[model samples]
Structure formats: C-alpha cells, structure tokens
Target chain A: MKKRGIGIGSIFYGTGYGNGFPDVSKAVAQLKSDGKIAIYVGATEVGQGAKTALSQIAAEVLGLSVDDIVFINEDTSITPDSGTAAASRQTYNTGNAIKLACEKLKRDILEVAKDYLGLNSIVGLTLKNGYVYPKTLPEKRVSLGEISESLESSLKEEAVFTAQTTEMDEETGQGAPYWPYTFSACGVEVEVDTETGRVEIIRAVLAQDVGRAINPELIEGQIDGGFAMGAGYALYEDLKIEKGKIKNNSFTNYLIPTSLDMPDIEKVIIEDPESTAPYGAKGIGEPVMIPVAPAILNAIYDAVGVRMTEIPVTPEKLLKAIKEKEMTYNEGKN
Target chain B: MKKIKLTVNKKEYMLEIKEDTRLIDLLRDVLGFTGVKEGCGEGECGACTVIMDGDIVNSCLVLAFQADGKEIITIEGVESEEEIHPIQQAFLDVGAVQCGFCTPGMILSAKALLDKNPSPTREEIRAAISGNLCRCTGYNKIVDAIERAALYLKRGK
Candidate 1:
C-alpha cells in the first residue's frame, strides 16, 4: 500500500543585497548610420533570461521591437556596472536602469527631432516604432533612421539606478534591510514507503507574487529549475565530507534530481506591481526555491509521521526515525 | 600512441592518439567538437553522452581505443548547415534550452531513444534521459521538447 500526503510552505524573500546598496547602470546609444539602438549593462544571464527580460524593458521604453534592441552585457569594459546577478535584483535593478537610459535616449531623439523638423513646440511629439510623430498628425512624422542619417552626431544616453536600503541597527538588529520583498507559497504532494523510507514527490504547485512578470515563460522556467534544486536538497543531494576534506565530489556520488526524479509542477503567478520598479517587475529567481524544501519535508511528515530535520533525508535516516517513532509509541501504550 | 580510424558525424577520420585518451577529449580537443561538454569525467552526469553504433554512451567513459571503427555522433552531427534537426527545433519551440549546458547531451539521449522507439511514453522518455543531469529547467520542458519532437518525427515534419 502507498501512503500519500500533502503539505504547504510559504516564504518572504527580500530583494537586493541584504543591508547593502545595490547599483545598476545602463547606457543606450543609437548607431549613427543605421539608427539601431544598443543597450549596455553588466548583468549576467545565468539561465534566468536577464538578457531577454532587460531587452524587453528597453524595447518597451524606446518604442522599438525587442529584436531591434541589441544587448551588450556582461563585459566590464563596454557595459556599465550592474551589480552581481544574485539576490534576485537583476529584473528590478538593471531593469530600472535600462528603462531610465531608454527614457533619456527618447528625450534626446525628441530634442533632435524638434530642431530638425523646425517645429516651434515639441509638445505632441511621440516616439513610436522607430519613428517620431505628432499625436494628432501622423503625416508630419520622420523615421528615426532618417533623423540619424541627417544628424552629425548619434543619440546616446546613460542612467544609473541605486537601490536604497537602511543598515541594520547594531544593537537592535532591526531595520529596512532591502528594497523589495517577494513572497511565495508552495504545496507538495508526496508518497512515502514505510518499509524503505523512500519519499517520492508526486506534484508541486507554486504560487509566487512577482511584482510583475516581464516574461511569463521565463518566470515559469525559473520556478521549475528552482523546484528541481529544492527537490534535490530535500531528498537526494548530499555532499559528504571527511576530516575537512570533500568527498563525493563527482556527480555519481553527489546526486542531483534527474529527469526521472522530477514531479509535475504547476505555477500560479500573482502580480502585485512595484511602483518604483521598471514595468512594475520584481525579482523571482531566488524566491521560487525558498518554499520548495519545506513543502516537501512537510509532505513527508504528513505521510509517515516522521519529523525530518536534516537535509537529503536519506533512506537510512528516515527509516531510523520511523522505527524510533514506532518504538516510542509502543512503549507509551505498554 | 595508437592510430585509430572512426566515423564521426558521418565523416571518417584517422587520428593518432594515446590509447588512454577519453572519447570526450578526442571529440572536444582533438577534433574541435567543443559541443561535447565534460561536466563530470565519470560517467554519472551523462553530459558527455554521444551516439556510438546507434546507442547512447557516455563519452567520458569510453577509451579512444575502444571507439575505433565505431560510428559516433555528437551534438554537432544533429544539424546541417541549412536547418537544425527536428529535435533541436522542438527544443526551441518548447522553450527547453536554458543555460544550455545540458542541452547537447539531453538532445543526444532523446535522439537515441527516439531512434529506437519513435513513439515513447512519458515515463519512457524520462527513463531515457535519467542519466543526463540538467541543473536548469527541471527536466519538464526538456521532456516536453522530446515529446513534441516525437510528434514532429511521427508527422514527418
């Protein structure tokens, strides 16, 4: 017989560096000859799709297609200082910087258009689809490429965004440590074999509040990857060490969840936009993993009534715990 | 050092290498097929999975001498100059490629499975790529890509 149970876990993760400032800078430049926009930021894409997401933000601001925005990122010499890709700050920090830079570039384009078109007032001018036009009069419009070809200089602008966070009090250890916090809840279903103490996760449903999802597909990918790592942490992965030396350093010994080990995952995204963030987007990278382990652990306890505190809840430990719990119950009855 | 002749990616090559050289090193270093990544020198991660005589084998575990006369296929072999393979397209369509470290190996494993069984169940697909470890995407999209690739193959797309 198989015993199945379900459990839930929730978490609140603070974005940006904890108790420290996070900075992001972006530069937007238009090619003088081709009028193509290039965005430069030092944000690394370690499978979180930072490049695609930030490019989307720039495209939204510049009124250009995402394909038209060329990203020059992760190169220190070329791109400005966008801090490390940790603490889930790229989407919020770098995104805002890119937005600001694009906004500045748009202003520069309008300034150039006002002078070139010989218009007295640039009130109703708007940038749309690589063209500048008056809101009411579409005929009196000029292609951005034409403006660039006519101008002697290219359009270039840069902006920096620094996230503000209060330092933790030395005596009280309490203060606003980060800019924004992302909250998430995960529910897991599991099956426990009482004889072997093996716990198999059957399904996982994660509900995350990501101020806004710039790309829903990318968000789902992050969530799914995070859940796999979380599942490995809960039941399969163990880094053995002996006398301060590492053991089980190879993949064969240090087990990660394989395709066979993963369970069905359901994602529920809740959008609670952040006013300060670009496109009202917050970070979802780290928050997706926070609740997974606890949810699986809770499911295991619900199934077999064993409180597993250690990670990698291996068969030996779980079996021992189960036996100990049964013995304690029998002793009390006797 | 020994002289060995093998067919790789439908091209034949005669090379001089040490008997102990691993197939992964031969493919990546000697032949410049850098698509074959080595995550673990051991056979566990399956990051170096390649097709050898119509079956998937971990390239890191196979000695170069043992590969003599055996036809080998790496990720580079899966696509032509004009178009990518149906499996590669399926991976892209299903959003399976992420960090892409595990993509080449995972695709080869799927290829091996699909070559043997054009119509595989979800569980069979999972079991086929069980040896391949991907730190990104949680294997869900990869599985989806494989299933979609199977459909494409069945429809002769």
Candidate 2:
C-alpha cells in the first residue's frame, strides 16, 4: 500500500558573527581616467553568487550597469576585512558597508558637479546612467567620465557597518543571538511504500522571508540548492563512524542526492524588507537549509504512522519502525 | 612503464607512463588539464568524467594504460578558439554554474547525451547527468540547461 503525507518547518535570523560583534568594511573607488567603479570587500563566493549579488548592489547604488563595476572579493591582500562568508552575513553586513561607501562617493561627485555646473544647492540633482543632472534641467548635465577627466585623480570612499546585539549573561546563558532574523518555511509531500519502507519525495514548496531579493534568480538558485542538500540530509547522507574513526568517508558509501533523487520544488520568495539591511535585503544562505529535514520527517510520520527520530531515515530504519508499530498494535488488541 | 599514444582535445601525445597511473592523473598532472576535478578520486562522484572514444567514462576509474590509442575529450576541448560550445553557453544562460567545480563533468555528460539523442525528455536529461554530482545549483538548473542546449542544438543556434 502507498500513502502520502505533508510536513512544515521554519528558520530564525542569524548573522555570521555571533551576537553580531564583528564590523564589516567596504571600499569603493572611481577610476579617474576610465570612470569605472571598483568595490573591494573580503567576502568569499562559495557558489553563493556573492560576486554577482554584491555587484548588483553596487551597480544599483552607482546608477551603472553591473558589468561596469569591478568587484575584488575574498582576496586578503587586496580587499578589506568584511568578515567571513558564513551565517549569511555578507549580504547584510558587507552590503550595507558598500551601500554607504557608494553614497559617500556619490555625494563627493555631486559636490564636484555642483561647483562645475554652478547649481545653487545640491537638491534636485540626481545621478543616472553615468550622468549627474538637475531634476528640471536634464540638458545641464555632466558625464561621470568627463568629471573624472577634469579631476585628474580617482575618487575613493570607504565605510564600515556593524550590527547591534547584546551579549549572553554568564549565569543565565541567555542573550540576543542575532540582530535581525531571516525566516523560512518548507512543506514537503512524500509517498511511503509500506512493504519496502522506501519513501519518495514528490513535491516541495518552500517559502522564505528574504527581506528583499537583490537578484531574484540567484535567490531561487539558493533555494533549490538548499533543498537538495536538505533532502540528502533527510534521506541518504550519513557518516558511519566506529570508535571515532570514519567508516564511510568516500562517496561510494556516503550518498548525496543525484538529479533523479531530487523532487519538484516550488520556491516562494517573500519580500518583508529589513530596515537594517542594504536595499532592504537580508541573508538567505544558511536559512534555506534549516527547515528541510524536519519537513521531510514530518511527512514520513504522516504517511506511515511512525515517528522517526534519527537523521537519514533510511529504508532499514523505516522498516524496523513499521514492524515495531505493528507489533505494538497487535499487543494492544490482545 | 609502457609507452601510450593518446589523442586528447585533438592533440596527439606519445608518453611513457606507469601502468597503475589513473587517467585522471595523466590528464591533470601530465597534460595540465585542471578542468577535470577530482571530488572523490573514485567513480561514484563522476567529477572526472571524460569522453573516451565516444563513450563517457570516469577518468579516475580508468587506468592510463586503458586509454592507449584512444581519442579523449576533456572540458578544455569542448570549445573552439572564438566561441564557447552550445552546451557551455546554455549552462551559463540558465545559471547552472555556481562554484563551477562540477561544470565540466556535467557539461560533458550533457554533451554525450545530446550526441546520442538530440531531443531528450526532461526525465532523460535527469537520467543522463545522474552520475555527475553538483552540490551548488541543484539539478534543476543543470537539467534546464541541458534541455535548453538540446533546443539550441536542434535549431542550430
């Protein structure tokens, strides 16, 4: 017999630095001769699209295409100390720093444009498409390239952003862990075969409150990748250790999800913008993986009427659980 | 040591290599093709997949002696001088590449499938690259890329 079930899970907000103590710094420089903008930050891109996402943030601030901005990241010799790439903190911490630095750069450039154009005040002057012009007088504008040529030196600015959080009390062992939280929920449908104890995930619907999606496509990629990892964690992946020695260290025994093992996934991105985040965008890296295992487990319980407490609910474990449950039911009837 | 003559990426190389040396070591260490990554150093992960005489095989599993007189194609050989292959382009267009570690093997698997059957169903695409493990983009985008590449190849785009 085949049975179907559904389950749900959630994640709290977390920054990489515990209690949000570390400060992330970013530097933005506009080249004098070429008028190109360069952003430097110490955030690594581990398949998370940090280079693309941060570039998009910088491009949005500078009013230029992403291709025009050069990003130097994760190079300790060149980039500043923006902090580690874990806990989904780079998008929030480094993003804010880059945004602030770009704002300062724009202000400095507008000052130059103000004096050159003989504008009364800085108000109503906006930068768009590499040009600075007054709101009403579009014709009276100066190109950023032209301004750079006249200045004869590059314009540079840097900023640092630190998130606020309270330390834990020693006696109580309680404290505010994160400044802002990223929430996510996942619902999964699973089909369980009673005879073989093999469960197949049919569909998964995941919803994340991402604050704002700097790049929507990238967010979807994160969600899909996260679900895959979660599915592996729930069904197949296990490190068989004996006497503190890893028995299954190779991929031949330790199974990760393949393309055939993945189910149909529907991602729902929720944009409840965070006031503290840059462009109202928060971190979604780690949050995407938190809720997946529990949802799959819950679905298994709903389908086979057995509560599985261990990770990687393998076929053997499920079969044992089913037998035990059946034995208990028989004893109760007697 | 035995002398083996192999054609890799259309280049002929005749070298004396150890009999026990895996094809992965030969291609990466001797031939300097770093695109073939070794995730597991075993046949399970399929990261070191290469086309050997029109058959996709794991380089880590095949011995250097086994590849003698065989025509092999690595990731470096997939593209021409001026433009990228349609499979690579489709992977890029569909955002299938992330850390890009598994991209070469994944692309080659897709290429092998397309060579066999130009227009494949979604299920077939998934089954074709099932051996290639990518931890980053999931298989969704990768499958999408292969499907898109099939269309591109069908239209000669």
Candidate 3:
C-alpha cells in the first residue's frame, strides 16, 4: 500500500560564529594604474560561488560591469582576512567588507575625477562606463585611464566590517546572539510505501529569505543542493558505529541522492533586505538545509499516521513501526 | 606485467600493466589521464565512469587486463583545440558545475546517452545518468544542460 502526504517546515539560522563570538572581515580595494579595479580578500570559494558573488558586489559599487574588476587570487600572504567560509558567513561578512572597501575606494576615485574634470564639487559627478561625467552633461567627461595617469600611482582603500552581538546569560542561556540571521520555509510532498518502508519525495519547494540575492542563479543552485542533502539525511544515509569504529564507512553502503532519486524542485526567492547587510543580501547556504529533514519527517507521519522520531526512517524500522501500530489498533478494536 | 594495447582519445597507447592494477590506475597513474576521478573504489559512486566500446563503465571496477583491446574515452578527450564540446558549453551556460568533482563523470554519462539517443526525454536523461552522482548543483541544472546540449548538437548537425 502506498500513501501520500504534504508537510511544511520552517526555521531561522544565524550566520557567522554566533553566541557572542567576534565576527569580523576586512577587504582591500585598489584602483590600479591600468584603469582597472583589484580586490584582495582571504575568502575561500568552496563551490558556493563566493568569489562570483563578491565580485558582483564590488562591481556594483563602482558602477562597472563584472569584468572590470580584477579579483586578486586569495592568498594569506597577499590578502586581508575575510574569515573562514563556514557558518554561511562568506556572503555577508566578506560581502560587507568588499562593499565598504569599494565605497571608500569610490570616494578616492571621485576626488581625482573632481580635479580632472575641473568641477567645483563631486556632488553631480558620477562614474559610469569607465568614465566620470556630470549627470546633466555627459560630454564633459574624463576617462578612468586619464585619472589613473594623472595620479602616477594606484589608489588603495581598505575597510573592516564587524558584527555586534552579545553572549547569552550564564544560567538562563538567553541573549540576542548572531547577526544577520537568515530564514526559510520548505514544503515537501512524499509517498511512503507501507510494505517496503520506502519514502519517495514527489516534489519539494523552498521559499527562502536571502536578505538580498547577489546572484539568483547561484542561490537557486545552493537551495537545490541543500535540499537534496537534507532528503538524504532524512531517509537514506545510515552511518553505523560499533566500539568506536565507523561501519559503512565508504559511499558504497552509505547512499546519496542520484539524478533519478531527486524530486521536482521549485525555488521561491523571498528577498526581505537586511539594512545592515551588504546590498541587503544574507547567506542562504546553512538556512536552506535546516528545514528539510523536519519537513520530510512530518510528511512521512502525515502519510501513514505514524510518529517517527529518529532519522533515516529506514525500511526495516518503518516496517517494524507499522506492524506495532497495527497490532495496537487491532487490540483496541477487540 | 602484460602488455595491452588500447586507444584513448583517438590516440593509441601500448602499455604494460601489473595484474593487480585496476583500469583506473592504468588510466590515471600510468597514462596520466587524471580526469577520471575515483570517489569510491567500488562501482557505486560512478565518479570514475568512462566510455569503453560505446558503453559507460566504472573504470575503478574494470581490471586493467580486461581492457586489452578496448577503445576508451575519458574526460580529457571530450574537448577539441578550437572549443569545448557542446555538452561542456551547455553545462556552463546552465550553471551545472559546482566544485566540479563529479562533472567529468556526469559529462561522460550525458555524452554516452546523447550519442546513443540524440533526442532524450527528461525521464530518459535521468535514467541514463542515474549511476553518476553529484552533490552540488543538484541534478536539475545538469539535466537542463543535457537537454540543451541535445538541441545544440542537433543544430550543429
């Protein structure tokens, strides 16, 4: 017998090392003499598209396309510290550092533009298409290359972004910790086979609040990947341990979602901007996966009216639970 | 060690392999074809997938001696000098690559499917590449990439 049910799960996650930990990131933006911009930050890209997102942020501030910015190769010796990539902090912490640095760098470039264009004030001057010009008169313009040549040296600006948070009380464990918290809500439809204890996800939709979407495509990809991991964690992965030794250590027995196993995924982006965040964009990496397991578990309970407490809900365990429930129901009938 | 003759990426190589060497070792260690990734030594992950005689096989499970007179195609052979394969281009255009650990295998599996059936439905594409696993980008974008690759291939023809 097969049964189906739909369930929803919602959660909130705080980005960075929360609980009163210091969260800080620094970035250096350079206006190179070659009329291009270079940004140096120690933010490692672990396939979450951190580099791309950061590059987009820097480019937006300078009114240039993504290609105009030269993203310096991240090296500890050459770049400022943007903190670790964990806790979904790269997009917010490093993004803010890059954004603040670029703002300062923009001001530095405008000073040269004001003098080069012989303008009384930089109030009406703006940088666009590799040139600085007045909004009213596009003809009275000076190229960035000319400004760089006039300076005879590159202009550098660095900025540090730190989050303000307070630790919890010693006994009550209550405090407003972690900054720029992200939230998400997920709905999943699943089918549970009573005889075999197989839970197949039919469809999954995640509505996430990304604070702001620096890159919508990358955020969608992250949501899909995170949901797949959550589904696997809820139904398939079985890491057995005995006497301090890990059994099923390899991927052979521990299964992950394959192309056929993944269900239809629909991403819904809910951008409720954070005032303090860079470009009002927050990290969606950790929060996307937080609500998936609970949703799947709830869907399983909804389908067969059985309360499942543990993870994976493997076939054997599900079948046993089903049988016990049936026995209890028959006894009550008698 | 026995000498075995095989054609890889349109190039012929006559190599000597130990009896205990796996096909992956022959390709990666001996021939320096490191594109075939081995996520698991067992045949489950399909990370070491390659085309052998027009069929996709996990190189990790095949013995080197068994591939004596076979023709194999690894990820290194998928691109030409002028441009990458249409499938590779489609993967990029569709945002199907992330971390790229499983990309080589996924591309090869998709290649094998397209070669056999130029026009595949979404279900068929899923069934064909079910053996390969990708943790990033999920499978949606990869499937979309393959569908787009099919279109590109037809237009080029």
Q: Candidate 2: where is the Cα deviation over 4 Å?
A: A169-175, A241-245
What tens digits encode model 2's per-residue C-alpha lDDT throughout B40-94? 8868888899999988999999999999999999999999999999999999898
Pairs that collide in candidate 3 are none
Which one wins by DockQ: 1 or 2? Answer: 1
Window of ten residues with lowest summed lDDT in model 2 chain B: B148-157
TM-score of chain B of 3: 0.98
Better of 1 and 2 by lDDT: 1
Q: Name the top DockQ candidate.
A: 1
lDDT of 3 by residue, A1-334 (tens): 9999988999999888888898999999998777889999999987889989999999999999889999974689999888998999988998999999999988988888988888888887889878998898899998777888898668999999998788989899899888878899999999999999889999999999999999998998899899988988888888889999998887778888888888868999999999999899999888988899999989988998888899888888888988899999999999
Estimate, for each residue in A120-227, the C-alpha lDDT of model 1 and write its tens digit. 777889888888988878788888888889877777888888887888999999999988888999999999888888888999899999999899988888889999
lDDT of 1 by residue, B31-139 (tens): 9999998988788888899999999999999999999999999999999889999999999998888899989999999999999999999899999999999998999
Candidates' RMSD to native:
1.6, 1.9, 1.6
lDDT of 2 by residue, A1-334 (tens): 8899998887675765765365555655554467778888888899899899888888898888998888888779978888888878889888988899888988998988998899988898988888899999999999988888888567888888878777777799899867678889999999998888888999999998889999888898899899999999999999989999999998889889999988768999999999989989998987898899999999999998899999899989998999999999999999
Q: Rate the local accuracy (lDDT) of all candidates.
A: 0.89, 0.88, 0.91
Candidate 3 lDDT at A253 equals 80
Please give the range of 10 consecutive residues that has the lowest summed lDDT in model 3 chain B.
B132-141
**Ignoring the other chain, what TM-score does chain B have in each prediction?**
0.97, 0.97, 0.98
